[model samples]
Target chain A: MVALRRAAGEVGRSVAVHTRARPAQPQLHPNPWDTYHHTVIEPRRRLGLDAVRRGMERGEIRDDLDVELVGDLFTGPLLIRTVIRPGATLEPGLAERIVDTVLEGLRPRT
Target chain B: MVALRRAAGEVGRSVAVHTRARPAQPQLHPNPWDTYHHTVIEPRRRLGLDAVRRGMERGEIRDDLDVELVGDLFTGPLLIRTVIRPGATLEPGLAERIVDTVLEGLRPRT
Candidate 1:
């Protein structure tokens, strides 16, 4: 859970910084959304997925989990709160709460 | 799980249909993203959120869960798989898998 929180927090903070910096730059592309997806979104997603997979390999996560789907499960909320949802700010314990839910979901059932 | 799957499937299908029909119409505004978010995304999110809350009230979900955050958990994947992920197609059992993870997380732990 700590790793999950740290990884998510790092990505979220960087995205916030990037968006705040965007206004200073002139519109460089007719399709900025596509560029944003390829450059910003995709790499971050890959990094998060890698983190999750590493957890699984370390016997921390379930081996039966679908990597892509589970990757979305973690990445989706971070993206939504940080970008899609309006007026969303980095509240205290935000990453911790997300990681808690995920850990509870992904923890091996006894 | 069935309710979750049905709700997600309906929303995913409608979004797919709407996007397919978009290209034929001339671009009406410079910022269609905002319009799309308001018209399509927000209401769908509310509906999904309502379902989770209802589940909690009925003792199907954990009473202590955060409603808005849980709503994001349910709505996030549907949007990601259906809209954000490029070349993503609606796969069989996708909604079931997503709901299974959520239910496992949200179910009152013994």
Candidate 2:
């Protein structure tokens, strides 16, 4: 989980740089989407899904939860800060906070 | 809550259209950021924050949670499907699913 949080934070920071560096005319760029998908989204999604799967196996997460959607829950807000919401600060510990909050929610109700 | 769901869905659909219609040369367009901020981000953030505040008042959501971050969790995934992830379907009930999942995670653990 610590590694996952670190990877997520690193990805968020890199994405911040990537978004800023995007050419104003994306069509002139050599398939930015492909680069973004392969480099950012795919790896991050896989890592998050794996983490969630392991959590389920350990009985930390709800068995019935859709893992893909759970991945989105983890990825979305970070992406919003780094990609969509311009000028929003990608504060430190954000990744950890998000993970903790979602995990708290996902813990099976006693 | 129903109204919030409906509004979120509508906003998601409208954002789909808005993104698709954006001029490739955004610099040539008239202050696209301003338009996007005013039309989409600000209003949606306000609505989500208001709903979360009401939930807190009702003892539904964790009062300690940052309402803005909670709003980001709801908005980010929808934006991911509609705006960030090209070729991803903004399927019906996506808004409801996101809302429900986040709310489930958010419900005051008692």
Which docking category, incorrect, acceptable, medium or high, applies to candidate 2? acceptable
State the C-alpha lDDT per candidate.
0.62, 0.66
Query: Fraction of native Cα contacts kept in each candidate?
Result: 0.27, 0.37
TM-score of 1: 0.73
Chain A accuracy as TM-score for every candidate: 0.69, 0.70
Q: State model 1's lDDT.
A: 0.62
lDDT of 2 at A44: 55
Across B1-110, the per-residue lDDT of candidate 1 in tens digits comes to 46755775565455544543333222334267567767876777677777777777766667677888776666566556544564676677676677678667522344
| Model 2: per-residue Cα lDDT at residue B69 | 82
TM-score of each: 0.73, 0.79
Kindly list the per-residue Cα lDDT of model 2 for residues B1-110, writing each as its tens digit: 57656655565555555655655665556598678668866775676678667766766667778877877777777766655566677777877887777767722333
* Per-residue lDDT of model 2, residues A1-110, tens digit only: 56655655565455545655655665556587677668766775676678677766766666677777776777777776765566787777887787677656522344
What does chain B score (TM) in every candidate? 0.66, 0.72
Q: Candidate 2: lDDT of B54?
A: 72
Error of 2 at A11 (Å): 4.9
